[model samples]
Target chain A: MTADQTAAWAEQAIAEAAHEPGSAHPSREEQVLLRIERARRRRPKVREERITLAHGAGGKATRTLIDAVFVDAFRNPALEPLGDGAVLDVNGGRLVFTTDSYVVSPLFFPGGDIGDLAVNGTVNDLAVCGARPLYLSAGFILEEGFPVADLRRITASMAAAAAHAGVTIVTGDTKVVQRGRGDGCYVTTSGVGVLEREITLGEPMVRPGDAVIVSGPIGEHGITIMIARGELDIEADLASDTAALHDIVATLLDAVPVRMLRDATRGGVATVLNEVAQAAQVSVVIEEPAIPVRPVVTGACELLGLDPLYVACEGRFVAVVDGDHADAAVAALRGHPLGEGAAVVGVVEADPAGLVLLKTAFGGTRIVDVLVGDPLPRIC
Target chain B: MLASQIRELCEPGRQYTFMEVCGGHTHTIYKHGLEDYLPEAVTLVHGPGCPVCVIPMGRVDDAIDLARRPGVIMTSFGDMMRVPGGQGSFLDAKAAGADIRMVYSPLDALKIARMNPDRTVVFMAIGFETTAPSTAMTVLRAAAEGLSNFFVFCNHVTIIPAIKAILDSPDQRLDGFIGPGHVSTVIGCRPYEFIAREYGKPLVCAGFEPLDILQSIHMLLRQLADGRADVENQYTRVVPWDGNRTALDVISRVMEVRPFFEWRGLGFISQSALRMREAYAAYDAEVLFDVPGVRVADPKACQCGEVLKGVLKPWECKVFGTACTPETPIGTCMVSSEGACAAYYNFGRFTRSRHKETSRT
Candidate 1:
């Protein structure tokens, strides 16, 4: 479905939820999302310090509100399909399986929520692993007092998103928690996909001559999440690069023989690169200017004392491909819709062991290492 | 820039050494890769800046004792949770069901005391002057509020006397100094004048900024090249000559410098530690405990002392990555992120071996 069709489907789902039988019933996750959204607002008009069950109820009101606002804003085909699961048909036998949990604080954010996150997170997880995601299963942990209406709206989005992904969510389970025992909702999803026949992905496969490539910009997802949470009072034009990148990967695989593929997740590019270097026992060099970084993300990171390289990413991925195929790989990626701004950011070299080096913009070098303590907690 | 100056200073075919007393300062330099920018003749020695590195086994044992006591809620900075005491680290106690809390600041400990009135809250106050003010403020406020269950095990130490300890030692041979950015912000450049006059060593009060450090290095090198040693201030933006008077006043009024204290690596240093005043005696965790002795004992097969003293490089220590790492730290230096060995292990060690091998051949 196109954008308009998804928008229309989202409206119908919202309308159905609002006037459905056993309306005003929301699941724990929906209620939690609403409360976090309310709490994260600039001028919170608090009538009472304590939360009530009405917030979680997915009745006509809950359905109408979420559909009219959240679903309406993040309108997409899979999200609009509003089915129970996403289904896909793969032509290849190779597959990648991955999962991710979305427990971000203030579950609702500027550009996305747990619903969109559920689809994008699992899809990206598989995409980074060199898989063309084929299916997804979402699990929800709800609180007892959550509203049915809110539940309908959230589930509606989950269904529509699964449909849009061209994948099937064949199975799911929902558990309820006692009021005050849970924050709102927690989403754990598993994704399985068939890999491209020509691709092989792993750290050990990253030989000395392979190149590391990144699609689009870095730090947008992390910065967008930070801005959504109001952690650093900063604004940016960046949105969460929270989308499935299987199509982009397929395009790259069509031209280049990938040695290894991995997503920059919790530890960002630095962590992912370090892991690759250690596993392959190869020295890695990342050019500062080659890797794409949005000015907004860079400015906000500079203001908040965060390193863009270490920030998390949901949509982007790093590819280690054969040296001779580097240009062909770049061209393949550039031809795809998701790989327009792709670039070869670094290369693998023979190192003694457990070494990752980052050559700075100023013609100097620094070690890009993992964060010692918990990094920006509550960040997805 | 100091990098340029260091390059020029070595033109006379001489070597210059600089020691940074503050651990935070040392981390800033390493984090920014400023160390490599310095010319070969210039060496920035890691000093005793990490409180976790300097904390004796006895105090850690004291903290563990408080943690293990029934109905006692012990709080500490995250770094202190992992440093092993003679008995066990706070993490070991926590894993074994002790009520141990990790707090960002002492204020969090105050809130913990307020929330859990049924349990006694013992805060392990550890750090140099950079963190002493906050701990002192908490103790003062607890006394004022008459919070009966709130207490502090004072392990606060000053930087000047510790630096003086190094300078006064018979084997002292440093050419110049890159004074701690954070500690100097608290103690100011005034107190360091005595070191310059008595020791005749150039002192550059550098900030943690890469440019500030590089600039301070330039200043120190210029002084050394002229055969003139004096105290200089490079981080004047946040710090002042007089320092934070309010914080210093509170510290002076409510605490006394320990007559003689046993630092972990530097051994016994005069007037290096702080103890609570009589007015706040009720909130002193040390007084509350009846531990027999505060003895000095080194960890088995550890080179933390030499590493902390600037006499040994982290790589020179036998157990750098072999027996002691951040994962299983045998010494305090291996545990704390700011500790010399840890910084070297985390960011530079893998490359260090590579650089060494390439140079040797």
Candidate 2:
């Protein structure tokens, strides 16, 4: 068939397939055409009229929302991929810019509050982009009824976290919303960091045979927040893993070769792995036994039917490193207090590119897809 | 036994089809990739135990209506927040300025009612017997506390009647059953004895763990290989043979089985649902709100009825992915996480690409 004929035929088949049932018998060309057409049609759309909680689930729905609305409206080379941070080129050097909003219910959680989260979250975002921790701008939206004492506590936390991360709070803004119009407080932080080192790393650098290493145990931050919200009514000695990762990242970079690094923040390590796999066109196969999870977090996740991999990790990150240097990288990370529980969790593969699979502890393999909606506690 | 050993014990030449009757089991099977442990000769079918999926659309519309009412706060489990109604989901209602809140448990709704004495709190009670007792206890507490504004829109379903209907259906081909662990914890294995005695099908009450599921599958395989059929408790740690008597008593006192209830895709099944008893009528949201009890027909393109009955696979439905999906579901089966279609779409899509995978209709 001619190119025009093929395109017309493909378009017709796709339109018909949307309205009609599958054909029992078709030509080989027609089958291929239908498969490709279906794949294109299944791409997520951000056409909803209003924002629902699903839009903020940090899952497929969230990705669709961001892509269709924000990314479509603000199309730029820096803002195209929608990574945690935008890597920008400026006069023979690179800078990483990223912003995140914290509106977690129960702003105060074990081990950290929204203030601690805001500082560490943005710093880690830029730190993962292979940037030197530099500066942050904090914006606070406070409710009319919010207590000044609470604000003082949060600001203190932010100051402590910034000082620990060696980043300056260069500028900030505060606004007060009407009563009942907001949660107690919401903090948004924008981070700017410069790339000083010659070493290069990113999702595109990941390749087949690269090793996947997690900085520490996963799911602590998510579970702690969930418990703090008084939803499950379960008790365990669990605390959020909210800490800066620049020190650990630097240590790993200096000791062994690294490909990509991402702090498992909103959507957890599973999401980071999926992004890396898709960017590099490689498959990520993670060993369930090798993934580090605290016992209490595991117990809570089991009760709530939440996957530890999908749970948020404020201080944890997944690093893709050269296979030969994985051991050394893990050793270097483990030497740091924040990365004490570092482990080699998975490896990239050539087959089934752009997919993440888990080798279960029971010796069976399953796809580790991105999180769907927010994980809810199931009765069973 | 390990999943590998369970696989080895399966009969090699013949196909054995076992149906998992709980959404939790379906979720576990998909989440832990337990399906990979099943031998090629065995096929597992998902059943309609998902309370959220079986909640008819008209009821959801009523919930949205009630949520939008002045001085009324409609509460529901987080799972029910995203389920689509004729207009939209509870989440959409909330987005549109409705007082719809997601409560972790029914007791939380009662507490909200107590705190906000001026507002009426309507809890959308959902789930099987596993969750029914909690709602019942909450209602009892509300009654004792004289909380007149606290109400329950009961949609609690009983599992056995639905299971019996599936067995009586013309398309019934299930060789065995993997019963819900949580429901069995409440009603016990006694409720499932009829399947073994009358239908001659083995029923294994299983837990929601990957290892527990593998063990249950092994038990079912043993029953098939030895030509024996009986109710076996694989989750002995939690579920006793007679079940929790205290919970059953509380349920019996506060609620009664409805003579007929409309299951979303399975049609009307007798004694398959629960409603607040007459003594607790004051606490019933349906009566307080004058709910129409309207029946909404399933979408024409949705084959969830056949899928629930195991007569058709999810992918076999004409609109499985094209018109029906988790993002914009046309069918209830696609909305709930535990629903068979959602499970397949989320965890089993890869199975469709593997030529060796077997799914019998």
Candidate 3:
């Protein structure tokens, strides 16, 4: 049918829904059609029909688009409050399952590649949910003209990352698209983990007096990837901080009463903190001096006019613990190999709830807002 | 110096308005929350320094037109992708099957041209002096290498003319100017002397760091307190008085100042923009392609023109938070993150509301 015919049919259905055999006493078919019409009207109309790069920017636009389409279509209690993953109760045991797709350009970077990033990303999602990641599923979509050597390197990296994280890739699938359809390859991974302890970790557990601790320095992974593209023409020893964080989480759990655990992924630490603040209805005040950022990362961010706080980190996670146990938490995190740079960066506050603020070294506080679109490189 | 010390320096009874004429400075001020420590009398007015934000809709439409060609590869700094044209944006065009790519530098566009021999690579060269020199160098390199496929859609603007336009405006009441550090690095402290000599507004060239901005503000206030209205350099490490002579020479050789150029918010200003010199006309995308050089007006509801002149604050605009948000921006000020409106909406709206409440009381 033509576009006009389809529209006419839809209009007829809606009209029938409005006027039935008996206007006062409608039939069951009429009631069903009326419900359908209401649902159709309630559906959101996105301004743009096609997806743009901003949809993946991990910002306000991304959230709106996700809520309008995916959340609306797959409406359920489990997925209602979007976190890193869904915590499902299987046979009276808590299980956390999460999935992420890796479509980063310049597949290979100084520290990691699409393969390792895919593995670490999924593992971190499950690990941050106060769970012990167990297994992962790898699915790849490769372009027809993609090199086999690159594919092998990515798969090997994934395997190495999985092994380091103590997780197995139980099942896998691969498909090849037409030459121009895909950018080399895209990897989508699903991770499953078991909740080892009875601790209930999330926004509910987050309190006003909680202390925020970061695993390491910020902006490494993002800057490394940008530099790897060979666009900036600046050389730095900076590399992606892509690592497995299950061990660090486990160690920190034993040392302190952790309230909330979150892996700073796509939107970086800023997004994660903003999510926590909004979800818990508490303000997060971070000290700029207390935050650890490598000089190289700072230089790169300075050149491009990008902020380190809003950049992505693959390996890092933020742990919020009760103020009483703040020191213990930092010590525990620092003792771990992945958390050597761990520091008490911020504190949860009562006022200005649902906002993240940074206490600048200049004795001023700035709002550490969520990432809005990609960090566009600028010369000035 | 601490921001608190600077805050103490701000005269409480009188409102001291300081305009930062660089987008990077605007970003730093908002991102670092430097405005929070300021006394109620001090206000930091964001200026028209964001190149991505000020590229009029007509230029973007022309870019999209050039991008839509069969074997054309349109390259630009990533910030320009989301900026709306008359129809939509470069992102929208890319989604609709345009070979648009984001580059960190003009050299990257040159590289793409080198890699794709058969494709015509067009770099949407935008920004102030900081970026113009690189574009000029790229053109010179293209010529040296005999790369006929490379072209530059030169939208590179001169900051001094734009600054002069702001200073000359009737409503411009800025006490001092926080000069753009990077732009000054290319065309140094010498050009900004006009502001102090002619308008008696102190211009302090500043770095992008939080501390750098705070110090610059402090320096400006010192000048205000001592009654010295002259151009000062706070970003002495990067920008010298004479500027980068080599880069300026390259820019002068390959490009020429346009007689008149239309700014999105500031309207038409003479010598406000740059174009390829006759010697490099063969590498100019505007002459080679059939782009409709149309003059599209800003949206009627948008108060960006007033905002650019520091006449109206970003939040004071009618459509600021409601219609003109970062997600769906209707005006040039809301397009790029570096834009004044976008910066306020993204990172400073909460503080802005608090300031509003304090001012009301």
TM-score sort, best first: 2, 3, 1
Shift in Å, residue A271, candidate 1: 2.1
**Positional deviation of A332 in candidate 2, in angstroms?**
0.9
Q: What is the lDDT of candidate 3?
A: 0.83
Tens-place lDDT per residue, model 3, A220-305, is 99989888877678899988999888889999988989888888877788888988887788888888899999999998898887
* TM-score of candidate 2 chain A against the true chain A: 0.90
Docking class of 3: incorrect
Query: Which scores higher on TM-score, 1 or 3?
Result: 3
lDDT of 1 by residue, A31-82 (tens): 4223322322212121212222212222212233445566777887545432
* lDDT by residue for model 1 (B205-317), tens: 88876788788888888887788888988899988877888889888877888897778878888888999888778888878876445453664456788888787777666
Evaluated against the true structure, the overall lDDT of model 2 is 0.83
Alpha-carbon error at B212 in model 3, in Å?
A: 4.9
**DockQ measured for candidate 1:** 0.05
What CAPRI grade goes to candidate 2?
Answer: acceptable
Leading candidate by DockQ: 2
